[model samples]
Target: MNLKLIKGMRIVAATHNPGKVPEIAALLGEDYEILTAGQLNLPEPDETETTFTGNAMLKARHAAEQSGEVALADDSGMSVAVLDGAPGIFSARWAGPGKDFAVAMKKVEDRLEEIGATDRAAWFTSALAVAWPGGPCVVVEGVVHGRLTFPPRGDRGFGYDPIFIPEGGALTFGEMEPAAKEAISHRTRAFAKLRAALID
Candidate 1:
């Protein structure tokens, strides 16, 4: 689905993660100019929120206030049901302090096994927030259901993608092609909703 924003409307994507920048740019379409918080040297506030929406808003607000432009931010993570929804907001830092997704995935697997959870039903959640300076802010969410697999597979994607297999798929997200994965990823679902809201 293609959507167009007003020309000359610069939007800041409030993320320092290189992984997210291009995806946001692609989702926002060509009419809107996309900028990164790192490029603008925008300060990142501590994400003390307990929910993805709150964290997304916090980052988007920071970017909007700093750049004096509308900002879009997304917070996403994997939630394992057997683990009691652990590693939710802390998905990025689950591996102690750094953004070590491999370690985080191992920890998740260990925790699940510790509980003897054979029916590992889980879901990936993504929340996209857009803040327009002092103007209104909007938050949209989307989820993709899946189950966990032993011994992470493939070398594509980041985070728990290597271990999580989406429903009706043979390969884990890490094993799927980028275009194939993007078609049904949690972030893509959320961004699709956000695009509809913003453009229509």
Candidate 2:
């Protein structure tokens, strides 16, 4: 868990999502060299775990073992109150094999309407894990309370951003600029905790 010595070492951001790369890099700052799994051409491991922490650790360990370097990974998703967290862990699966967020958004709206539920309460949860080659792993989680919006919103973020409006925020995550969203995002919150742990 002592990551201070790794300040200048190369670390792998164990994810294939391009959108997540910059966000993670921003949080990691310039202290370390960041590389994505895709950049390293590392094969993705199956996310068969049932929880965010489990999946995040799984990915981080996989990347670390493969690259023989410290690796960081995150598992994040939207959980709808009305749906009883239906897509909590399966958020990506909800989009099917093609990863079509558009269809996934529609399904959310349809489910909401079908249930006749007015409460659109939801939250985004992110679990971040860091693993060192043949070493122990650390995991932390953060959540952003919010509500789901019908018809979706802007074209900014990937996944469910178009339909998620944060608490006390007028604009949806999709409508906000990257920096704006990053300021209060679930990932940001998780990264903050992870960063603190590392710095400590």
Candidate 3:
């Protein structure tokens, strides 16, 4: 996205998720000042788009327009191979209005049982977008393949972390230390792509 070309030191993180800000900041490092939509009380725009890249771009564009600065946004979710990505974009909605991830996790388990599906293959996908006020935008996507675990596990991460076991890893994301998970996270991979674009 040629972040260096952007004429500013401050950029808005176009998200309200409490868990996402710190992770994104850590990934972006200290080169730019990071501010969030919540900090500025920016109203969240409706995520009417259907794809990760579409949603991420929607949020980034909204934030940049509102804040008059560059903005970054991400849309991420878990896609089950058997479910044919049932909750791909609906991952958040699966948590229902209360946003109770516990309930959502159970729903996934129940569905698997109902279908008698034994293949637990799944993947976490993240699409990141950066946009400037009334100008250019760039989007990138990254994924981490994994399998689902029933009854969930651990208590370290938010969302579906407790149920996902990364490829070649014995521990679920919720079971890993924050730094450990960050090292191979889907978000981390996506951020690497974004960072490369900026630095290149």
Candidate 4:
């Protein structure tokens, strides 16, 4: 079966994270009806995979199989160059069971301090995957280079946004308006490929 998203299709978003819900819906735009695994009461699957694409594919497929519909999932994280990508796949876990990004951000900052890292070069990586029930999936990844900022700033976006300043940008993702952030977000960059392959 050809897996494609129609103009008014209903599909599971394969995520339970509140912050990710709106972001995914916004990134996918209004053409499609986006439902969440949480909304459907589908249990969030364990992300056992080590890579973004691997985890994304697992989530998407599980959601698709359970929901009996097309499913899309995103696995993303921030990696510090100096930290040797310390929090790469464990981004969410870094936030702990409470999922408090504030604590997670502090952990990152403390790690940087521990190493006396002067170069704050960092990057955000996003993996987007779409799967059809009992069918194959398509996955794509996008990355945006940037550096870390101290003390965090703003409160617009979620997760590690406040501490990350995208390359060639003055404001952190948290400081930028939703539309502004979307214009240069790792999710947007990643979804562009999915749009080309399945939507458009």
Root-mean-square deviation of candidate 4: 1.5
For model 4, what is the alpha-carbon lDDT of residue 195? 89
Please provide, for model 4 over 111-200, each residue's C-alpha lDDT reduced to its tens digit, 9 standing for 90 to 100: 989988899999999999999999999999989999999899999989999999999998999899988887878888999988898878
lDDT of each: 0.86, 0.90, 0.90, 0.90
For residue 30, model 4's alpha carbon misses the true position, in angstroms, by 1.9
Q: Using Cα atoms with residue i matched to residue i, what is each candidate's TM-score against the true structure?
A: 0.93, 0.93, 0.94, 0.94
lDDT of 1 by residue, 32-87 (tens): 77888988888888998999999999888888888898888889998888788888
Off by over 4 Å in 4: 18-21
The residue pairs found clashing in candidate 3 are none
Cα lDDT of model 3 by residue, 1-200, tens digit: 44553334788899876666667667887667788988889999999999999999999999999999888999999999999897898999999999999999999999999999999999999999999999888899999999999889999989999999999999999999989998899999998998788744
How well is each residue in 1-200 modelled by candidate 2, as lDDT tens digits?
56652567788999877776666678878778888998899999999999999999999999999999889999999999989987899998899999999989998999999989999999999999999999999999999999988888999988999999999998999999989998999989998899788854
Estimate the TM-score for candidate 1.
0.93
Looking at model 4, which ten-residue stretch has the lowest summed lDDT? 17-26
How much does each candidate deviate from the true structure in C-alpha RMSD? Answer: 2.8, 1.6, 1.8, 1.5
